[model samples]
Target: MRATMAARGHGRRLAAALWLVVVAASAASARFVVEKNGVKVLSPRSLRGHHEASIDAKLATGCDPFGAASPFKSRSGRPVVLLVDRGGCYFALKTWNAQEAGAAAVLVADIVDEPLLTMDTPEEQTPDMAFLANITAPSALISKRFGDALRLAAADSSSSSSSSSEEVVIRLDWRESMPNPDSRVEYEFWTNSNDECGARCDEQQSFVSSFRGHAQLLEKSGFAAFTPHYITWFCPEEYLQTRQCEAQCINKGRYCAPDPEQEIGAGYDGKDVVLENLRQLCVHRVASARNVSWVWWDFVVDYRVRCSMKEEKYSRQCARDVVSSLGLPVEMVEECMGDPEADADNDVLRTEQIVQVGQGSRGDVTILPTLVINNVQYRGKLESTAVLKAICAGFKESTEPPVCLTQDLETDECLNNNGGCWRDDKTNITACKDTYRGRICECPVVDGVQYQGDGYMDCKAVGPGRCAVDNGGCWKGTRDGKTFSACAGSESLSGCSCPAGFKGDGLHCEDIDECGEKLACSCPSCSCKNTWGGYDCSCGSGLLYIKVEDTCVGKSTSAMGWLATALVLSCLVGSGIVGFAFYKYRLRRYMDSEVMAIMSQYMPLDSQTTENRPLREEAVQA
Candidate 1:
């Protein structure tokens, strides 16, 4: 029994020696120094906020070391500052519950030999604890060495002093070591996340370029998210403002909380200026001139200021200066600088026109920035890459552009392989993925036809054409008595359509046979073969489709048949008419000669006739 007791006493002495050694080492590496009355103690850095709190309460070791207790009585009415060890629960939770139990502050001691660290509970890990916004009271972490020294001091005082008043009066003050600034430091939350990727990720590229300088500031600050301070101010509106904005603003005496009225402006509040510029340039100006992109590019690349938010006069001056500096066309500059609000009525009309046009084209089916291909709005992101993909899919004339085959963008459900294929207007052929069902090549089924493939492939073996029956054709309602299966990854069918061999609406389907009906073969007599939706006419040689009258009126092949037929008909008719006229004349002459002989016999030719005959014979002889 004596040997056991001796071993226990030796073990206690060794433990006490080890604690003293830890205290000596902590004093050397300690970064925070806490003071009470005149006694100074080393502490560690923990929690971020106002670095100091002053409370005059007798230190209390809560019933539970981690402060997980309902009520712990304090020796005085002064604010109670509890001494708690790190563990058992979240530091935030402990501080919060201790505060609820009427403690003014909770000082947590590290269990390890490491220096103090600010409490960090990521929401991803403890999803319920997003932020310690609820913790109003101050909480800090001190070194285990410091905690041990305090506990030892209290014990020593309790043993030596009177039994009724063995309490050590103390003060806890967190004095920050940062040098004082001339004025208050200000902060702002600004970002360029909404800047659009025009035609490409121009905005993103621009942001990447500008963010390079800020990388060091971010590293030094040791923040997970951007915290704007007074250091970063010159960044463009399209770029995020970090500490630089606040710093510059303060330097310029412009650092003030954003005025609500100023933020809520006249016509441009909450508007996407970059997107609006893209729309005006690509959709409007491009329609008029092919080289408009250069102007738009110059504006985005050179005009760094976001003048749209400025007052009218300043905006106009800035715009004019930019245009003059760029040496762009005067008319173009004038047109762009005209007051947007001055033409409010015109703006409304234009808006109405745009909406009306979109509605008419899409049958009131889609919203703004609609991606329509052959009258079908593509169901994809309104980004440059997605728009390019949709456009590439609509082309059935030739293979897709090289970019379409190789270009890849990060999609919501897709891991960008950066070497994938665009399948069709409706789907993209992406890298294979392991899904819940199984590993499968990523492709989409369109119009009831499953286009399963690993890489680049056609939407259909024989793609639809502009003239195809299903391309922009009116609804046939169903096919083969079954409902049309066009609902899958396709637009609705509602357009003009005609049956085979016809060239008009279904109601007025006029037969447009190229050979027989309209003599389109241009031959007098041609053999016509009617085919699906068309016909082929074989005329005798020398005959072809005539463009003049659009009729087949040629003669015989390899010969002039029409001319010969016309000659023969004209000769026969002429000869018959001549023969009938000659015969009538000859009969009339014979009847006249007989009538004269009968009259002469009935009435003697008078003597005057005999004399006239002799005279006539003499005159005739002369």
Candidate 2:
């Protein structure tokens, strides 16, 4: 027993010597410092102006060290901010959630939130570091307003009140170093005179560009989510004139005068301004990095310093200017962002390289699949849903909002057709997407009157001498007296079209029976035959069956039948008129008389259309 005691004594002495070495090493690595109120905190060099938030506490250890209790305030309607030792997994839900709940700071008390001391790092053999996520801290502010009411009453009278009440200041760091998809390394913040990301709430309350610099780091790092300081001034908004009293505003490590309006408890806060400033910083930073293709490019672009949008002087300039300065390419510019289609042929585009991403062709239905081009989405292995959403939202910049057939924007819900949403226009149940424009969400105009130097022809000009579409919009000349078909190529039919080879004006375009010319046969033994649109070239003049190019034959031996057919074709504009007009009538059967009346009422200025027989200006769309 005495030998065992000696062995234990030796081990204790050796462990004490090792403890001294660790303490000395830590003293060398870490220095003690104090930060009073209103110190300017700067973000890391790589991440500009990233500041760590702070929170006050009751006793450094709120919960019993050996027992258990919660840090959550049951009376608080605001979301819970778990004040454990180290800020970690339990409450770090996401930045979005934090911002939504209006959490100004985080406080991690002592290990009472746990029964034992939880170190910042985990032991190697431990399979799961479940304790790492909960917040842990040595000590914290004891008298701050938040902590004053939270102090738990303890019956242990031997514990000195001063000891429990004493405040402990700690450097601002993510109390717990946790790895998350949105951010890998937690930011540790400190303040110095030259910290560059914040701005004074002076005249314009202009924001310094550096704050955004840090946010861009988070974005580029591919963090799924994040939240920065939604800072609030701890001091009162009204200034204290006494020189002895500390200044309430924290500006660059010094307290300065803030506007009476900007004093704490001011109804109109700069929270939105803070949000916008971050967004602007993102824009400037991302733009600096060559070309930006991402769309989660979050920023504040809404109007400011304006009471109404209708006033000409009221500028949506804040939003418009920030967005415009990023210098987006024409194809990258959002369509509806106040700028309308300046050029008819102009198109919005997004490209990783040479592939044509979105080509809004005329009659191409709608761009409603307001996302990656329909086929492209399914084609490429998009990294995540984020990539898909970004491509789609970016592609949707300036796309038309859907207007239901009911003509109501609010009530119109997109209807699902076979695959895409159906357009509201009753006549054309074609697929419509957010990207569609014009009356029917028809594809952008790509052709037609555009070819004409003048803007476009009106409906009145849809007749004979007018610039009307002819022959299915393929050829455009008035017909005289010739039948046209696929047999007759899409060429103008005029002049006494002669039979093809002979080329005189008898039956315009008929193949002349040149085989009847005995000498033209070139060989008395050869035979040649003729057909419309072309004829067979051969040796014998009898009947050649070869499908040749130019074998024009003279009048056939069966001439009596041909003469009668020519008489009808000569009956002005050819006997083909009735058939062609009927086919066209199939397309224009009848107009909705009721709709015409409604349109007429709306267009009372259209003097040409009177009440009796409303002369509708039949505009022919090409």
Candidate 3:
């Protein structure tokens, strides 16, 4: 049976992270403010403080005197927006206030007269309280109701010098230092404009929607900007030489001596700065705006440090400063989770306020009306809200990949996906992961983690396993659980067979040319030698024939019976003829001797003893 197994990880460093997520969040939004260039708000009248505002709440029709913990407590089953009496509350302060009000979150809004428009900075500055929402989007609706109630109370307390819980009225017209926060609502824009001014103005408007900061908002919405922070390495000029770079690795770089070259309109100009455009690219691309994450150095931090300076001493310092700057905030990291973590601070305005305008009971009365509309935080950088909005929109921010992927072990379309790993098409297993990929979703965590070349990146096993995308065509990886050997059809990473004569480099397949290698040889003269898949030798039939097919040719007489018979016939005929001729000669000699003996009349049988006296005449036959 196929089962769906989900693996979850909380704390992962993003590539040049632009944002983070908060836990236990109620909900969130992709709120943005795109209307203001630099709006400055003005109200004809002044409004009372929070103390007076709550008193006025009592007068509202729905006001519950001594409300049960929170007015919206019973509304938990539904999405509830915390409605604050005013905007300009920071996350820490607003978070606390929202809890106090029994609100999931708070939306602080201006009285329509004072809405800010632009920002040049982000973190913090002088105290011109910006209302960064610590609540949720429902707070916006609540703000409307809260504002309406305040107006009603204003009428009741307007004429009287007495301090009734009634609200004070501020009849006002408005001008924004930037753009109007309300314009975002009117325009139906999903995000702020791309420029700094637009981002700041939109941030101000967006802040009024919630004071939870980026983290909580993302958590609540179950949405995140998939933007990755881009961090680039600008090496020193000397690293260009491949050999030198291989040796020291500190000198390679595209940047000029003083400053690295930048892809943007402005080149590095002899100064090393974090690449802003690169960061934006990452935030917009890799990490995205939907599932926000942080940025880590991956495996390049050490290498990057070395590349930063010509001298080790200077490079070390530069690397240290850069990394420190790049590191995520402790509290932010803790939000996800980590070791030796401490409780997060709940202070309001932990960061300095970036903008300033007026001063009053709210601490910036002249700017109060705009504060309510622009949603400045009570504490923190004035444009932090805007920065957040920019982060979410993925226009001003982006995400960069820790590494690039190569095509090999997977099918052609596997890489088309943003994720480098492949999925099992048959099982519909997206997490199945490629065997040789750098990043795997299901790779072991902690105790079982396996990586390539140490622990820099996680690795996994995938199939129908083929070849590795690395130098070796062989995919039978064994190191780090990689094996470069396998059955015939099931070759390793390269998915390559030895090709009848080829070999492998452990990561991939290569050709093994026997002929080119001088492995082939002549017969008999050549002794045989074996190689990867073929054998070459000197075994030929020309030297001395060993009749393997016809075993009984010259060695067997029966097989040559015809010739042997002819030889016997010739010997018999010659012997018979010679005997006949000898017989004839003897007969003729006997006849001649008889004639001679007859004439001489002295031939006898006993002549043999007296050959000299008988004169052989008796043998002549008279």
Candidate 4:
């Protein structure tokens, strides 16, 4: 009997040792540093929100169950991490209270000595618990022993008079929360298609809409690989034939979701959601096969907007319209989705269920819209910027993509109301410029022309090329197919002025009436008539108006006038004839001289001596 009892005692010891090994292996490895003594304590992150992996703040003890303690306040405007006991209320409520009191983070110390468990949002969401989705602070659960040490430190510091002992400061290091094994980051988004489920659903849709562009960018650049997932529950065998199962389960109770409106025989049933979920899953599969999986983001975003449950447009046809609009293979997706009436598992949805289970370091996906980066769950608000930051953190230190290093993710803010900046409706030119840091209200340079102004109210085109853009933002008019603008020639650098035929400020010009203003046709013989931009003038018969002198002259007539004109014409003709006769005589004399000179050169004439006797004698001597 003694030998058997000793063997049993040894068996118990061995079993306990094995249990410790299992617990240690499964526990999260994140830790925080106690600045006072340089001691490190294990504090695994537990909440889901935006975690500031690089956080250093002062620690304050506010053990009050209601979070009404004054110690929670930070006197120096430094970040305060509140330490609260674990049992006063729900874990989420504690964090909420701490958050309301302006605590940067909350640490819920376990009241009893036990293994640290993850603090999760409540299973059932209540109207008052709306704060769950808005919590941006990172939280963690620490061991009881460490909690005791922190509480003791807080007491000592508060009681002591030394400035150094006034408060305890620690740095919460979450750098290891996400594993960055390589340059490429692989992430998964667990979401649902039901948009009528309230805040969580709204958040999921918002995230998908806002982050679609960024996700597609990363995927196209090969910086990240993203997969989308949906969660479905299986109906129990006993309740398979019940009305609840009929309203929710699809494929004969194999997959299911809760009714969107939570009412029987009203609005959209839960099976509708399951079917849509299956369709979305197949969209990704079909797109992946075609090597254009990024289209999945487009389909999901478009479907959410075009086919929403609240709008009662969440049907198969609506989904097909979205699929077709994105140029996806509708038949292939239909084939992948299979039949929802079949009393068997869907190939695509079955795989989704298998992947939903925890593998490696990732835990089961229990929360709606959970983001898994590098096989580790991301904790933060479901915002595009926050989620993008978490994904960026998963890259190996220096291997982050350019998008990750940017200060802000591109939101395409210029799409809405032109980002509240000045715009020229006619030219479609805007002053809003979209950048990595959201939208900037600075004038834009378009087509080599720079705009100048405050950008928010008005932007005027400037420089030599300005006239080509919206006519330099100046007044312009068109009449009778003739268009006139206040802008000067392209060489004119800036400023607008009324043209020659119009008058007003540069922004608005009215055509000037030359006839009405008496600016033209002032001569008595001229007729005054106004045209669009100028005036027309006419003169009486036998009279001519000189435009340069702005006057009219009468035509001469009668016998005396005729005789004088004829005499002048006769004299001009006589002079012309005399000039021609003189020209011919001169030409004849010159030709005769040329002929005589040529004959003398060839043979001596009677009147011409061989040159001179002296010349002849010189030639003979030579």
Pairing residues by index, what is the TM-score of model 4? 0.55
What C-alpha lDDT, on a 0 to 100 scale, does residue 526 get in candidate 1?
Answer: 57
| Backbone clash count, each prediction separately | 12, 41, 134, 3
How do these models rank on TM-score, best leading? Answer: 4, 1, 3, 2
TM-score of each: 0.24, 0.19, 0.21, 0.55
lDDT of 4: 0.69
Give, for candidate 2, the lowest lDDT window spanning 10 residues: 15-24
Q: Global CA lDDT of candidate 2, please?
A: 0.27
Candidate number with the higher TM-score (1 or 2): 1
**lDDT tens per residue, model 3, 1-622:** 0111111012110010000111111111212231221111122123222211111100111111223453333211332323333334333344344444444332233345443222212245234333233322111112343344433333333344554332211211111111222212111011211112233434533443333343334433443322111112234445554432222212133211122322323322322232222222232223222333323222123323343323323232343344346443333322221221123321111111212222222222222113222232111233444333322222111121111112412233334462544343432434323321123344322222222222123243333322222212233433345243432433432223444554764345444555456545432344446544454443333332223321222324443566778888889999999999999999999999988778666645554456665556766775
The reply for model 1, stretches above 4 Å from the true place, is 1-70, 125-131, 155-166, 175-178, 181-622
lDDT of 1 by residue, 194-273 (tens): 22312223333353344433322322333112121111112244423444333222212222122212343433322223
483 Cα displacement, candidate 1 (Å): 99
lDDT by residue (tens digit), candidate 4, 542-566: 8766667767676654356678999
The CA root-mean-square deviation of candidate 1, after full C-alpha superposition on the true structure, stands at: 28.0
TM-score for candidate 2, residues paired by index? 0.19
Assess each prediction's global lDDT (C-alpha) against the native: 0.37, 0.27, 0.30, 0.69
Indicate which candidate wins on lDDT: 4
TM-score-best of 2 and 3? 3
